[model samples]
Target: MATDLRTSELKEPVDVAEYLFRRLREVGVRSIHGLPGDYNLVALDYISKNGLKWVGNANELNAGYAADGYARVKGISALVTTFGVGELSAVNAIAGAYSEYVPVVHIVGYPSTISQRNGMLLHHTLGNGDFRVFSNISREISCAVAMLNDAHEAATLIDDAIRKCYLLSRPVYISLPTDIVQKKVEGERLKTPIDLNFPPNDAEKEDYVVSVVLKYLQSAKNPVILVDACAIRHRALNEVHKLVEKSGIPTFVAPMGKGAINETLPNYGGVYAGDGSNTGVRERVESADLVLSIGAIKSDFNTAGFTYQVSQLNTIDFHSSYVRVKYSEYPGVRMNGVLRKVTAQMGQLSIQAGPTPNNEIPQEELLSPEPTITQAWFWPRLGQWLQPEDIVITETGTANFGSWETRFPRDVTAISQVLWGSIGYATGSCQGAALAAKDLAAEAGADQVPRRTILFTGDGSFQLTAQEVGTMLRNGLNPIIFVICNEGYTIERYIHGWDADYNDVQPWDYKAVPAALGGRPDQLATYVVKSRQQTEELFMDREFVDPKCKKLRFVEIYMDRDDAPKVLKMTAEAAARTNAKLE
Candidate 1:
């Protein structure tokens, strides 16, 4: 076989692989994160030849997560791997990015067309021969999926996927067949600009919808605006702030949308779930006459399992689809644009009332409770120990409960890979965030200040990625790791309707794991707290505040599986309902 090595110079022909690589680069993808295999050799060659950095990961899940972390810091990230097993491993992380509204481009190489059609059992082939395996897996998780079987169409399809990811701010999958990468096509200058223009709304319908929402806003005595992750993912933070400021409406953020508006704002009611759900915030959300839900997905976790009733007559839900005013609807525009337009039309409304109701219990009342081993009572005292600028990373299982029960000061940062709903994301993410925080503080000349990174992982999740603790120890990064010792996947138990046996996990002495992983016990302290009082005492202990401690610290808090928070109970119920509906 004569190879056309100099085809570009001789015939002005474009190599399909080169075209795909160029498209990725044009979209500002700085690096490709994934594990390479024989199935993706051609694509890997192109990536290497194009001078793009390929970050090899231990597994596809971590690769997807690392890409997600990069996207969180930068704007867009890319990941590439082989078919089937590789793609499946990454599904959790990709799904998480989708839920969180992070833009990521996932490239998966497929078996050649001939092999796919001839029924030749490829190395990674499952029962199915179709190379579109990733397409089905990504259907619900990604904003879009494109498979490039034709070399000629590869440029346009690749570009389209990238553009969609950027515009939708969600993960998109692009599948490349092995043969397509080896083919050649005529080179043409590609037009790669994104069309930012949104489809116009029916003017009359929009005006009517706007009028109805305005009327409800004007009439309600205690209208509250609840912003969620969608709003933040759509970059509507400033617009949401404006809406809250102008309407004089008390504003609350769903757990995922925390930090959208500065918690210090006077109208800021506090976070609705997770560590922000102090008593007053919950009451305000439950009692509001009119609830304006901007970019809120009524997910079970965020809505406390749908236990609280929303006044549909006065509830206006603005989703990615349309402006839903009570019962009437308008064509959906981009989220941030729609919110900005609505707030702009409302003109200048003043802050309607006094500071948002303080819902915190008195210290005396909290202390009066006889100390017991439980998450509910332990969370409140833990909140007092958190300081501003400290970032909290929670694993999916415990995060669902901790986010609802724990209350932190307004300035604290809470982070979780919620959308992907992966169990083991916290440990790796904490390492990434901690590294970033350290760099940020150093650049700002605040290197002397102590930076705290906290991870709240369920026992199940902690076991999967516990190896990262050694990374922290080697790097001399001190992060407080609190393991919720329920002895299994609590979230799964909830999902399975308290089928404890299947949900029950093998218990490990988490505090001992760190010590076994070459972490120093003196600098790396471990404690087991069975009661809220013990938790409080540990947090208030002066030893934790010592600046000299530069080793990983572990804390294990024991709680009965049945004693999970009300929000978790509700979430599990809703999941059951959803499953029942599906069945």
Candidate 2:
């Protein structure tokens, strides 16, 4: 029996900050990321009081990225910042969250209602005393926007904004006035908690879409399953896995959906990166008569510059909002529910018997540990060495493209900003991902093996948000940070200037970053690997891979300044041609 969350007999009075924090806590936000500001200081005080720790980031932008990472694992996360300057600083990360469908509640602290009404000049204001400008800017990126100026109706607005954040799986904005932080409000609404139950499906639309999908699926001689980024966003991975297992169809994941499915499955093919796909991935997907595409996000990076060859006549696109079978589309039919039904009814429906998916990745020669580590040798070794449930965070430049060919384990989770394609996002997000992994481990019980967080980033990207390494140390996180030191923005160099000074970056003592970033030298190990011999030794070391190590490790792997992954090289040439032609 379900516990009735609503209670009409009792009501308590609580401050606005208490209500907000309590509500966030109820929804599984253990740590709130933010930068301290006078406007939001009072609210920050309530965080610890409510059993939540404040994850003080080095900057607001980092806080935003960290919040996004946490939300990706915990389902929802919160980030607090000052009204104007602080909020604007985080807008880029918030926009990325909106694009990627991560639920993050951006709480901003604003001046009091009196100051706004009187047009008083404030430090964070635009000098004209207009408080509405920043909120207007937020409206464009957030799914819902709310200003908590009226204490009487503040609860409703807060609940509504948070609901939109979770339901849409995107960012939402909440502006809390300084004076409203401690304002007394009735807490009767808190008894019910935030309503997280998704809306019921329209039976007719669901049935119609399912039937159409079955029709196409049954008739096809060769059918395939393509999972995309939205599968993880919409929480449809389990259902998708079931559908693939039951249907016994060949499955291939898009670039952004690298870890959305178990790559170890015999029917699981490699990533689909348009023309850049591995030897057989693109051909197998395009040649299929019927394609089941779940939660697809067709960004340029994921689709190899919009070069997908699949046609509408052979595609069944299952999206979060609707489902499409060839020429016909059913509105308001979510795949989350429909997939479970489809999986249960798989035997009753028709399906094609096809060849098992080829799970072969390009094999590398058994090189004797060479003096230098090349792209050819590094990525394949990393893929083969990865353990189950090790979360990998790749930066936008070489790391992202280099990770494309890496096969993940059964429950591995991969994180990247493919759609937003933001540089300097991985380091900050790595902090949150590690913390979330810790929380997840605790929840899984002592018997469960602890999950490790591994981050692969380039030199240029790391320079932008390098301060988060200190935050990680302060929080006692033990992530393996691999800095690919190629001496510059190699990704950019591949696009325009092969040897342009503008693309050059100053060399850093990457191995010293851990100790320099407040990590105790003894508690951390730093190593520089200029050869395959060193990399293999470090990767195979028990201290680096085991949970009992109890220390973070930073490894700097050196490569040629002009070297880059083949996929990135190909994409760069294509991008350059398009740019030269003004396409």
Candidate 3:
């Protein structure tokens, strides 16, 4: 009994619970995030024993959101739930993870296999005794799904689920029966790391595709590089940077790709979204003889509702698994390798895009500004105050659309669920992102510059998951939260109702939210800014975002209820037209 459990020499068979948790630790899980249920109580007993802290969230949906946020920063994250109800409550968050390519392992503890087979009704089930329903639903959203009924195969199942979560950078599902929680399983698989075999490209095909892309690059009179969200998801930011630098091609970022490439780069063009693009960006890209697009996701919000003018014939795409050059296609040609090859040979190519089209980044005009903050005045100023190494999470509201225009500082990782379009995401995601940043900062030693985890959310979105603020407080995480006080669903208003009562939300005292959410007064700082003068005083103050501050800060900024970013307004019009009947 006294033998050290941590020692690898012990080679003893361990319970399935120990096996599962230890495997997660080996793959870089520092903590587990979820709500506790009766089905998982026994499994929870082994959490602290394995040296992992349980991040008890206020609800399953928020737990899923937090876990997704954590996974985006930490490389992979796991969430534990119980049976059908708890797991189903997190489905929306899981879907968001899938759309955005965040690797999250969602584990569900269910009734024993004996009960399921005997048709015993379970509390969380629909009373139909059909245990396969939830798993079937999960299969649609997850890259991999495994339900473990046999102890002998549990190790391999768990390993497969974890590997899928990483390889695809998406959510994976695992079902664990209650009776199997303590079953004995082999521990030998723990010695070797998870075998994540990503196959290499075919030699001849790889060379052919690379040559085709390079030939276009050298011959084009105006070649443009377009970077999008996939560049961040596939871990190709470094390669994209090298390609842009070496080719000397003018680069533009899609809305989903706001923070992937540093905006300060000399050849950096402004944001491009068809009709919503910055001045001169759309014209330059559409006029190009060839466009080198990397990880481009053409979501509605990302492309201004598919208003793009660039043709497929002039576009050469570098995707995660394949390459598309004009009309020809090359499957199994990995982009990671292709990008490296293209970047290395850039020195031999001739430059084409002339004079490097430029536009002056917008600056806030303070003269005769509104008494209350307006969307136009605020976003630009917010960008001016951003610092290096800041982690930003924006919700799917005015914050999401407005933030696309802001130029981020160097190393600032901005996260927005534009493709998923989930409201209330930033509240829970900021909690997870902050914890990840804090954990990474601690690992970097005592002298590392502190990284800020900041959240920009609308009032309606905040109400959906404000309880997560308590989770942040409990963990002693310091994140700056800016709640946009626009009265209701402004984004929804833009799309459908201009003055509908359904779009209105109950107003609450925003400053008292922290205390109502169980945050101690001394542990938090609150601010309510109603005027342009006040907004400037707070964000511009160097002491407000000071790295030395140890308390979480919350700020509520008031703006017009109908106000929205110009790009979002345009997209909303397009969305309305799409929803309308034949004219």
Using Cα atoms with residue i matched to residue i, what is each candidate's TM-score against the true structure? 0.78, 0.95, 0.95
User: Per-residue CA lDDT of candidate 3, range 83-149, in tens?
Assistant: 8899999999999999899999998998898999998987988899899999999999999998888
Task: List all candidate RMSDs to the true structure.
Answer: 5.2, 4.1, 3.4
Judge candidate 2 against the unseen true structure and give its global Cα lDDT, from 0 to 1. Answer: 0.85
On lDDT, the stronger of 1 and 3 is 3
1-583, model 1: which lDDT tens digit per residue? Answer: 7765545443456777787777776666646778787778878988868867565666788677767755654457788888888989888888888878888898888888788778677777776666556588798988888888776566667777887887788999988888888777655644535453445566666666667777777667777888887776665667777777666688877867764665656777766753235456766776777888888765656655555566677788877667777786666544455566678787544334433533354475466766666555555556656776677777876555655455566556667765456778887666545554554455467556546778788888887777767656655668888888877887777778466576777878777987787877655888898876677677777767554456667888888766666566656767777878953
Candidate with the larger TM-score of 1 and 2: 2
- Report clashes for each candidate as comma-separated counts: 9, 0, 0
Off by over 4 Å in 2: 1-10, 348-370, 445-450
Candidates sorted on TM-score, descending: 2, 3, 1
The residue pairs that clash in candidate 2, if any, are none
lDDT tens digits by residue: candidate 2, 1-583: 6532332222676889999999898888889998988899988999999988888999999999999888887789999999898999999999999999999999998889999999998898889978899999989899999899887778889899888888889999998998999877778788897888778689887877777777777777778899999989888888999998777788888888988988788778788878878667887889889899998998877877677899989999998888988888888888888888877766643444433433233355354444767776677778878888888999987888888877777788899999997789999999998888777677788866457889999999999899999999998888999999998899899899887898887888888877888789767988888887788898888988796567888889898887787888888887777778853
TM-score of 2: 0.95
lDDT (Cα, 0-100) at 550 in candidate 3: 72
